[model samples]
Target: MQRMIEFPTAFWVSQYTIRFAFQEEISAENSRNVRLFRTFLQQALSADLLEVVASYATVTAYVKRKVALQPLREQWYAQQASIEVSVSHTPIQIPLCYDEEFALDMQRVMDYTGLAYEQIKQLHLAKVYRVYVIGFLPGFPYLGELAEALFVPRLAKPRQRVAASSVGIGGAQTGIYPLDSPGGWNIIGKTPLKLFQMQRAQPFLLDVGDCIQFYEITKAEFRQMEVNSY
Candidate 1:
């Protein structure tokens, strides 16, 4: 079966960098295509390629030399038919505690959305969010397409110090603060898991393309997990 998709438009970003734009919109399909093409380019370029970064709808490649469009297009034509995108990976369950002690902006969210605390919590738990991009801070996973009912705007003034592991919702996206940093997202809960541990073999717990499902935990359980994490 020859699966056909619109080939990405590749353009030069700099003397040594090129960017392949898969699509304009952010969706699961666009991400898969960007990742797939990124993999192909890495293998295709081989020795000439320095690094490749896959984002929501773009793949930026840093290379040793310039690349041609026609050959890459031809290569894509030959390979696209055989390769299939798979989103079969199981969702990683992230334990979230929504206790008032941790949910700093709970009342704000409740007031804006016209929902009670339990409703807000349940709605937040309903969907399995995709890791759309990793930015803002290191290891900060921008999970997205939050349920419309839970969509609340970021704070008018960003917080000076959002604690590490604080889970928050900002507009259409939800994310966690991987470290103590200034942030604007509405804080809904906190996770005990260490998202960024430089000492570990894998420094980041989450990456782009990962699926996350958050489950509620008691404040006591949150404390115990915090203890166990250390």
Candidate 2:
């Protein structure tokens, strides 16, 4: 069965790069539409396609040769109403430790939201977030639509080194740092899971359109899981 897809405004980014623009803002519907379209293009242009990338609201395809706009547009219009793309909706449970040691910016978050630490933690755990787009770092999952009360701005100054698996909230979104890299998202917790384990058959624990839920864990539990991760 084919999915009901909305045709995006297609444009040429370059001679060999074509982009499909969906909605201008980030939302679950837009993400789904973008992913579906990317999947469609991969199959439709298999011979000419080099690579396809999906963001919040756009799909960019790198091709082997220049694809004329008229023919591509005709194909896009013809295929718009029938495109099949499989997407997983099962929520992955991420165990998080929100103890003072790992939550470096918890105080800042508390001050900004005027919510107690317990309230903040509960708010974060209450919602199932969607992986809107993965970027900024390899295997990083930009989960979105965070609980309204838990929303807080990113740090004014990004940290020089944010530990891998550190979970943080920024405005209406939340995400986990997959590697030790500089970041500005307000750090609220840390996860024991290695989000970007290159040694594994599947390098990434999350992907675009995937769902996630966070569960609270004690420091001792976190250490146990951390030791087992290796």
Candidate 3:
């Protein structure tokens, strides 16, 4: 984050949208650019901006068919590299109950990773994972780059209904199921915290570029906590 450098990127445009693809590998540097671009976008774009989304390595700007986009493109080139709006790297702790009652598929995860329960738990809590993007479900954070030893494949068939706050991993990424929704991520734990609340000013608990740290909790504690987890 100390680097006051302008990272390289490629700009692509089509009839309805423009995309700025970060050319380098995903890192804190690229994440900073995304933060800056997101901030600039909100301040620069008006109703002409139909929709905007930032991904792991790209920012997509959607616009109406009749809107001319050259001006907005200029705005990006002028200030997209600024880091004034960079997100805080502070790690937010999420309490997870890994007890069998909540850890729906612990045995499966251990069998696939060839790891003991302690190893799996420690490895996940070892590093503060960065949120690369938010998608798949409302307030569902796509957090990443799991330890190679923790790598596992998705279930052959997706689950019909997963409980909200259920923490799971598929392939190389991990995430929470905000609401009881169909998903394929192998469930290993559940969080007591409310990840999304529609009535709150900021509905989502985690944002792109924010860091997450998971800590263990007991089933009793999970139940003791109030239902309003916001």
Model 1 steric clash pairs: none
How much lDDT does each candidate structure score? 0.88, 0.87, 0.78
Q: Once model 1 is optimally superposed onto the true structure by TM-score, how far is the C-alpha of residue 192 displaced, in angstroms? A: 1.2
Expressed as tens digits, the lDDT of each residue in 1-230 for candidate 3 is 44443433545477777776775467766776776676666667666678888877787778665454577666666765563645467789998888887778789999998899989988887777888889989989988868878888998899999999899988888898888999898888999887898888988898887888988888888887636465
Tens-digit lDDT string for candidate 1 (1-230): 54587778888999999988877898988876776777778778889999988889998999998888798889888876555544345799999999999999999999999999999999899999888888889999989879999989999999999999999999998999999999999999999998998998999998777888999999999999999984
The alpha-carbon lDDT assigned to residue 75 of candidate 1 equals 85
Q: Which stretches of candidate 2 lie over 4 Å from their true place?
A: 1-3, 68-85
Worst 10 residues of 2 by lDDT: 80-89
Ranking, lDDT, top scorer first: 1, 2, 3
Deviation of model 2 at 188, angstroms? 0.6
What's the TM for model 1? 0.92
Candidate 3 CA-lDDT value = 0.78
The candidate maximizing TM-score is: 1
Listed in order, each prediction's TM-score against the native is 0.92, 0.90, 0.85
